[model samples]
Target: MKKVYTAIDDFKKQGLDMEIPLKLLMFTGLRNHSLSLLKVGDINWIEEIIVYNAGIDNSKHKVQFLPIPPGLMAALKRYIEENNLKFNDNLCYGIKGIPLQNKQLNRITDKICWDIVNQRTFNFI
Candidate 1:
């Protein structure tokens, strides 16, 4: 597996929004499943925190809070603004207003990282 630095560089080369999700995943250590379920309201813009309200069916424990690092917060804010995301919008989405499944999110994210590494090395090779 390539290191994160290489992955990030490749992602940057690939360009635009490619690195944001990766950054979020890396910073929060959130499982793809949990991350997909996040809504805009889950983020406290003023406090710069993400509140994971794990419902009874989904959560093993209970509500959890993760501090939004400055970088992550900035990225998220940019993403929201760029996408013109509503305040009540779900953070992750799929086609035609469909929500992304956890499995799908995992697949996409994994492929992104994998492609980043492969492409970076490919350029040098």
Candidate 2:
């Protein structure tokens, strides 16, 4: 966990755009699929929970509200404000302001893990 976090920090320091989304996955333990589909409106500012609507056919729960820790919530709020995101806007998007694909999110995880295992830098770009 520590190594993975270190890699993520490196990514952030290098100014990669997926920092927040990576942190969200770490903090919330949400799958890449769910994280990819997350929207600004899915976050409940008052309740401090993320409203996850799992639309998969085999999903056990169609809807779930995941609690957000104070630290993460604050960071998320800042990210939203900095990006000028609207309610309908995707929480995590690319430089083009398009929602990140599931493959991209998975690549983040893979890069971190590879770096940790190989003891070397892994570039996300």
Superposed by TM-score, candidate 1 places the C-alpha of residue 38 at a distance from the truth, in angstroms, of: 0.5
Give lDDT tens digits, candidate 2, residues 25-93.
887888888888899999999999999987666657578788998888998999999989999898987
TM per prediction = 0.70, 0.85
TM-score of 1: 0.70
lDDT for model 2, on a 0 to 1 scale? 0.80
lDDT (C-alpha, whole model) for all candidates = 0.66, 0.80
- Cα misplacement distance, residue 45 of candidate 1 (Å): 1.6
The most accurate candidate by lDDT is 2
